[model samples]
Target: MDAYRGFVMLLMAAELLQFHRLHEAFPSSVLWGLLAYHQSHVEWAGCSLHDLIQPSFSFLVGVALPYSLASRLGRGQSLQTQFSHALRRSLILILLGIFLRSTHREQTYFTFEDTLTQIGLGYPFLFLLGTTRPRTQWIALAGILVGYWLLFVLYPAPGPNFAYEAVGVPPDWPEHYTGLAAHFNKNSNAAWAFDRWFLNLFPREKSFLFNGGGYATLSFIPTLGTMLLGLLAGQWLRAGLPARALLRRFLIAGAVGLALGLLLDVTGLCPIVKRIWTPAWVLFSGGWCCWLMALFYGLIDVAGKRRWAFFLTVIGMNSIAIYCLVHLIDQFIINSFHIHLGHGPFQVLGPAYEPLLTGAATLGVFYLILLWMYRRRLFIRI
Candidate 1:
């Protein structure tokens, strides 16, 4: 867990750097690859390492849920109490998501399309659906996936029987189907007209072709399946299975998931577009998520050697807080200041280096704040 956390934190640091254009200055091949691996969000039609990040986070949420809920249940909490607590937590996540979305200067109002909001909206419902019999949960997951597929495939968006070309855009250019949904719904703010238009016209028919519907409602289906997979693993771990047995399970499941995802991709049932959250993408990503959790569980919970994993663990412990802080620091604080490195003693550096210096400075500031919060034991829990 600690190592995983540290890995994610370092990845986050790299992401921050890339986001701020620091990546171009101190361009190490290894760092570039790592950044590329983590930062290259899948273009509409294909999957990439970056696409896995969000789903992985969601998968972790599911992975933790059973353990946390079971811990509460073990303490003799009633089912009603547990359900209510879950709902409250879900609500908090949803509100926090809205808060994040609203923080965007371009957005005029809260929308359910935001990542955190989607998690907030989807997760509790996932949990509720999951708690039922395994068969029922499986059925529900299938129902959603197929239902969503049919909704876009047959009914089409904007209106029933909408023509595909009318909604289509150039293949290589980045597109936003959700933005289109937002536009059609008039949910997007008017400040960003180009973004709004692109988002709204995102194709409905060939979403599986690219980054189509990954963020759309259809994604919840396979995502729920991923959660169920996590639940099964959690149950296995809870059953007092031997460490080797758990490791074997992780390897086997990961292999199966990868294989299945690849098969789906090849067969064209659902091309592996992470943005659209196709079943293939879900299976592949979820498979990786399972293996990662298993690895963390083995090392942290079983092996009991965790000194190096502290950094990421800290970030993970305060994932939401860190996410919000990262955003706030970037959007409002640093950008607003417009502090230049070339002004004084820092004038030794040229214009090209300014971005790097500024990025490092911002990251350093955020890290210090995180360090202080960690020291004060002031962990934010939503």
Candidate 2:
């Protein structure tokens, strides 16, 4: 779990790499183009490596819940105490996410769609569910996905004459779905309408408009579904199935999830939109998360390959600290490098490689901090 988590955080920290900078430098290079694409988000109704980051992080939260509950109970913690902690943690995560979002703004951003906030919003419910049986967890997951889907389907779709530009969608946006799927189109769904009203309740530079990226606070609902999937997987891990059985379970679950999500997308019952955390996306992204867990578990635990994962374990153990470090001070570190060492060092290989090199140095700085914490056995838990 630590290795897989470290891998996820590494991907997040690597955003400093800004592979997109290579677009102009290697316009025709397929590998670079793929790298650039994976490093960024698709406009809508599709997936990318960047897209998996949030789900993977959210999924891990659920994956850890079984263990979290067990550890607390083992230490004689009461259910009331656990509930209080979960509640407190939820508030902190939501506020922290808002704090992070507001760093560049004049006031608190007041958004709940951030990865941490999304997890925070649903964390308590997840904790409550943690006390239930595995059958109940499965039911909760189904209810969330189906209920969210129905809510979107029941909401009125945009009229033919509706203005797309009014909601920040481009005039020529080519990803718009037609027919039933139109209900899930960007900035025009039930979630968007809810945000238009919900977000305006908070102070802002201007009236709450559609999110430029079409993200909505209500995404936390399906995000909960994603987490529930992880919760189930974590329970499976705790069940102590033999190595081969666990691998088979995860592979089958992953394949089923992928197939079902794609079926929903192709049949137009729902579109897989990560921005809104659609039901299809819950399945699709969850599938990938499970497969990742299986791979990390099989290789690290089953194959006895522990040394290779030490680097990731360091990062994974300090995930929260690094998240804050990267968000709060990554630019400072980047600037320090350019100021003290000068751009010449990063540009040694030519302008095309400068972004990658500078980013690598910044990432190295992050890793060193994490390594220091790891060596000292320092871990920041919620």
Candidate 3:
């Protein structure tokens, strides 16, 4: 679990690399093109390596929850106390996400589209599902996806006059999408509509229009399904199944999810979009997450090859702290390196390499902090 979570955090923290800069610096470089594509979020209705970060994080939260609950119970805590802790954790996650988003704003952002906030909103329900039997949990997952799909399909599609530009969607965008699929078009879906009114309920510097990226606060609904999938995986892990059996199950589940998600997308039943956390996306990304868990579990826990994962486990151990630190103090760390190490060191390779150099320094600083915390057995969890 730590290794998997750490891998996700490492991916998140790697955003400091500014892949676009590299791409711009070497537009014709095949390596940069590939890196840029994987690091950046897809504009709409598709997935990328970067897109998996949030799902992985949310999925891991589910993976960790059963273990967390068992630990609490083992400590003699009552159910009420566990509920209180879950509630408190949920509140903290939401507030932390908001606070992070509002860092430079004059007022609260009132947006819940971030992975943290989405997880926060959905966590209580995930906790409830966590306590249910696997069959019950599967039912809940299906219900949530079907209910959300119905909400989109049943809701009236935006009329022809809908202002796609206002939401940063080009008029001719997504050339292949039409008909029912168009209902879930960027910034025109039911979730986007909900945010139009929902975000406005809070005080805002401007009237809430549409999210430029087509993200919606209600994505937490399906995000819970992603987490529920993780919870099921966690439960399987705890069942003491044979290692090969466990790995096979994860691989088979991943294949099923991937195939099912593609079927939905190809059939136009649902588009596999990560931006909206579409039901198809839940399964698609959940499949990848399952495979990742299998790989990590097999290599580290099952095969007993633990040393290579040490670096990732360090960051994973203090994942929350690194999450906050990267967002909050990234610039400070980068600037500090410039002031202390001097520009000569970073500029040695040439000015084109500056972003990469500085990014490396900042990432190093972040990892060192995590390493220190790990060595001292200090993990900050919400």
Candidate 4:
């Protein structure tokens, strides 16, 4: 399920990027719709389909936790051994995330701010917390969210005064909070220097001590909540409930999550903002994750529809490979081939065709490579 979703997301991203590149070649609405779907990340505030992507990834981590742990336990692994394994896995993921973040033309060392790193850093804490009784996990999850809210809300710097009063503040106030956090953490990329200078009140030198408010920190709390929910779902799924019962539970949970999120947003206690990973953001994004899981569970596990599942399963099975491949392809292969469609034998095609045709061809080539690997049973795991 995880690999399948990841593959779908990657293809969606590629299709969106392709459509964006061909905006001028297609109808305005079609182009704009694709662009909107691709542009899922919230600009600085509020929720969008784009914002759901990362949360979905985190949610899947949670969903898989129960099954993975049970399998380990079945193998006669002690609790400590299982935990050690989880910790090791988390560390590897974090390192990989750091590798991705620092894989720049100029960088030579790891950085700890990327999504994978955040997940890697966050997951062990979650696993440790989750290993307790379910009720205890729920309490811990709630405690984390409430504690985070209190910490940021009452924190002397970056809240109420600095965040509330900042002029021309980005819609996502959390970005400013991250700036404050980056100041203290001093783990930021220089590429974002201009963004820091203009949006944040304190200069890098002065406010370096106060940099930890944005989505990254909030992620610590709400994401834990997300993982908790996933754990809960995993537990429920593993309890041998009937398919209909599971589906009903998922729908009910999703509805409740969405309702609570909306209510919180309406009350202004927590705005549905992804950049900040606000509490409302948690419920909203989590609702979507639940819905997707329900749908997939029904379609694949319940319905026994395995034909279409293979594609996503392949990508899912070797998701990390696919992610790295996509990135490398975009950075090196596709960019290197500046096909001049209007020259020589390709003279008939215009400049506009270059982006569309080239992008399609490149994507097709990569997809085929993935397909071939899948057929040959060459699943890569890390």
lDDT of 4: 0.63
Candidate 3 local accuracy as lDDT?
A: 0.90
Per-residue lDDT, model 4, residue 229, is 81
What residue runs in model 2 are displaced by over 4 Å at the alpha carbon?
A: none
In model 4, what lDDT does residue 155 have? 38
Best by TM-score: 2
Q: Which residue window of length 10 is worst by lDDT in model 1?
A: 183-192
Give the candidates in order of lDDT, highest first. Answer: 2, 3, 4, 1
Candidate 3 clashing pairs?
Answer: none
Per-residue C-alpha lDDT of model 2 across residues 163-217, encoded as one tens digit per residue: 9999998767899888999999999999999999999999998998899999999
TM-score for every candidate vs. truth? 0.76, 0.99, 0.98, 0.79
On lDDT, the stronger of 1 and 3 is 3
lDDT of each: 0.59, 0.92, 0.90, 0.63
User: Compared with the true structure, what per-residue lDDT tens digits does model 3 show for residues 298-351?
Assistant: 999789999999999999989899999998999988888888888889888888
Candidate 4: where is the Cα deviation over 4 Å?
2-4, 11-16, 23-31, 108-111, 156-218, 339-350
**C-alpha displacement of 333 in model 1, angstroms?**
4.6
lDDT of 4 by residue, 65-139 (tens): 888888888999998998888789888887777566556545433344455666777788878866778889878
Worst 10 residues of 2 by lDDT: 169-178
For candidate 1, the per-residue lDDT at 195 reads 33
For every model shown, the clashing-pair count is: 14, 0, 0, 14
Tell me the tens digit of each residue's lDDT in model 1 across 1-382: 4356445545555565553243455466566555655576755555565666677666666667777777887899987887788788878876877666556454433344455665676777766764677677667756765554444334323333333343343323344333223221111112122333444453332222222232443344456665666666666666788888888888888888888878866665555656446566767877787788777877777788677567667666667677778756574545644654333432247765555556666767776777788888888875
